[model samples]
Target: MLTPMLASLLPLLLLCRISFCQYSSDQCSWKGSGLTHEGHTRDVEQVYLRCSQGSLEWLYPTGAIIVNLRPNTISPVAARLSVCIKPSTDSSGTNIYLDRNGKLRLLLREQDQAQGKVHCFSIQEGALFIEAIPHMDIRRRITAFQYELVSDRLRVEAESLSAPCQPCSNTDMLLAVCTSDFVARGSIKKVDQEEDHSSVTVELSRLYRQKIQVFVSGGVRVRSWTGHINMPLQCGVRSGEGEFLFTGTVRFGEAWMGCAPRYKDFLRLYHEAQLQGNNPCQVDTD
Candidate 1:
């Protein structure tokens, strides 16, 4: 009872629907020889592994599981190094390592799935050797933690070995500004000459708000500019020449210099303060 044109169109529509469903599933498979850790030769066989739905369900849209076939040879100095399954969509994936003690540590991008199967490769004397792990269930072995959107990319914390997980908090510029007494742009002049003291002079380029002062017991008072602030010294801002963004107690004269920010970060914080209808320089009473 159907027209010829209508019948032909129906078949095409069904095919299109099937293709759409496949794409939406986000299913992935591995397409290369397995990882090689001990030799320079590549395995000739191509292995295909399906992504586990149980693992992919837990990750952010950008999260993925990594199966480190050999964790010991990941170091730069190691003669035989292997890397497989690098995510193509995101070049900013964090490098995680399994230490000898079985503790998984993040190698880059502290703090924070394309469910895909990646082929592992071993490098020897400048030649790439494929390493293979047969019938590996990667999803069950790796654990992901703290998957959150960080800027344009999803920041994820994950471990390769099956073990207990520790949580990490997400701290951004706005959170830092809201928690501190004041935020400003400044530069470190020099480390003070006092013995056994961790003090530095900061030349304030711009103060977001006026400085504050506080008094303690015994009628003693401290200034915020005296470097009583507890900023991490290892932030590499100690060279004392380049400009930086600082946040700390203005009254106590202690300031911690964080890294420099883009112009948009300062603008974003400025607008955030406007939304709250409160002064950004207001001191914390608690």
Candidate 2:
């Protein structure tokens, strides 16, 4: 009762329909369940996420899912981008892996998800392959994480573990001003020591440039700006320290200290460079 052509087309059409129902397109965040066909299908679905940052949640684990994350706009750093994922403290039910051409490398195991640690890999490494860990009861299991795409320059030794703590040379200071996310003349007002890093409160006398308004303007009365930046505890940054020419990177909406030097030292270096016409960029030192 059926022609050969119709029978072959039937399977293809059904596959397309199933795929459409499985994933959302062009989404920055994704939320879905692992329940599948016949309630035991162990099917693998493809998820496409286009954004620099987002979150994913999967409930009722059963099968697997491949998450494809790529930038929406092409940029020079696109090729150098890395993916960072912070697993939720309670996330479970799946083992995460990297999938390239079907070859898989484990990224996270099920038991480790509860640790809520952040993991990173290059974008070129592959899509995220999250496979459900087999369990009899699928009722209470879920996997969730927040992800961010960042350039290599922006993705340094996070939490100040390997963050550069040495004083920037005269040349590096000049260059940092030209390329850093924020530059200002400031002083440490308070330093809160943490296990691995120190949180520094800064009062900026002059803000040269900033990627965003991370520093709150003190207005006419206060006549300056104030903000916070994190530094490696080993840096020994302390409150009441003398003024500094501050520079650093802002990651995930938080500022991280970079090549900060004594304001007096920077003034001397800057003046010498200006006299020599070797300064990378002009700054109003007044």
Candidate 3:
């Protein structure tokens, strides 16, 4: 809610002096308590975080916080970076906004934070303004979310994880194999359709790389990997398929399909690129 009070509140929050900040040299993540300013409910604090990806947690939120997010790497690409935040499922107690200069734009209401949806904005937009929603009993209140700086130009609006309806080009596929969060050889074991997306279970024969522990390795004797990838429902992806090379990005702890082609096709393309000395990166297909 853009109450008239917010207009006045914005300036106060923005101009607030640096107080007891929960920052570190690396400053990737921040965890603090609004109880620190418990007596001053109208007080404000500015938090600076420099990282490509990180999280913030505010316990017992009382006053307000201005979260300034910036990428650690300083370059022209920083201007093009999109800051995406996924609210914690249990997050509550504060309203979030985009604060540009003294102007405020609502990003998320306190209640909406419970839905745990992802939100994106350009780095040039503004710092995040999170104001505590006044409540008598702030004992059980907390506001938290994970943020990521997405720089992929292919992702028109920062939803870069999910592939579109059309298959990726040979060149994109090659790049994805090299740059994706996870690269694996697998087949669709199950496909569970959802309202907005489809969850595909991949029975992986080999997991060459993973940015995180998305795939689990079975016991030593069993020797296997299994993981799930989300895809756009319109892709019409099904369970039946030959072996495929799966390469995709991970967003908010979930894998999303990217450039995936049949294993044979990828082998052929890789071999051709290798002979031409044009492969972006090498994969040990052997």
lDDT of 1 by residue, 198-268 (tens): 45566554455434542121223522232333333333225444665555433113333322454355556
Query: Candidate 2 has what TM-score?
Result: 0.78
The 10 consecutive residues of candidate 1 with the worst lDDT sum are: 146-155
- For model 1, the stretches where C-alpha displacement exceeds 4 angstroms are 1-171, 192-197, 214-236, 250-253, 256-286
Minimal lDDT window, size 10, model 2 = 1-10
Candidate 3 colliding pairs: none
What's each prediction's TM-score? 0.25, 0.78, 0.86
Q: What is the lDDT of residue 29 in candidate 1?
A: 30
lDDT of 3 at 271: 96
Per-residue lDDT for 1-286 in model 3, tens only?
Answer: 5665465565565456433543434488888887777545776777899988899998988778889999877899888888889899899988999988767789898889987767788889899989888777546878999999887453442453343576689898899888888999989999999767899999989989999999999869877899899888878888885999998778877887888899999999999999999999888988
Worst-scoring 10-residue span by lDDT in model 3? 154-163
Q: Return the candidate ranking by TM-score, descending.
A: 3, 2, 1
Global Cα lDDT for candidate 2? 0.78
Judging by lDDT against the true structure, name the best candidate: 3
State model 1's lDDT.
0.32
Clashes of each: 18, 0, 0
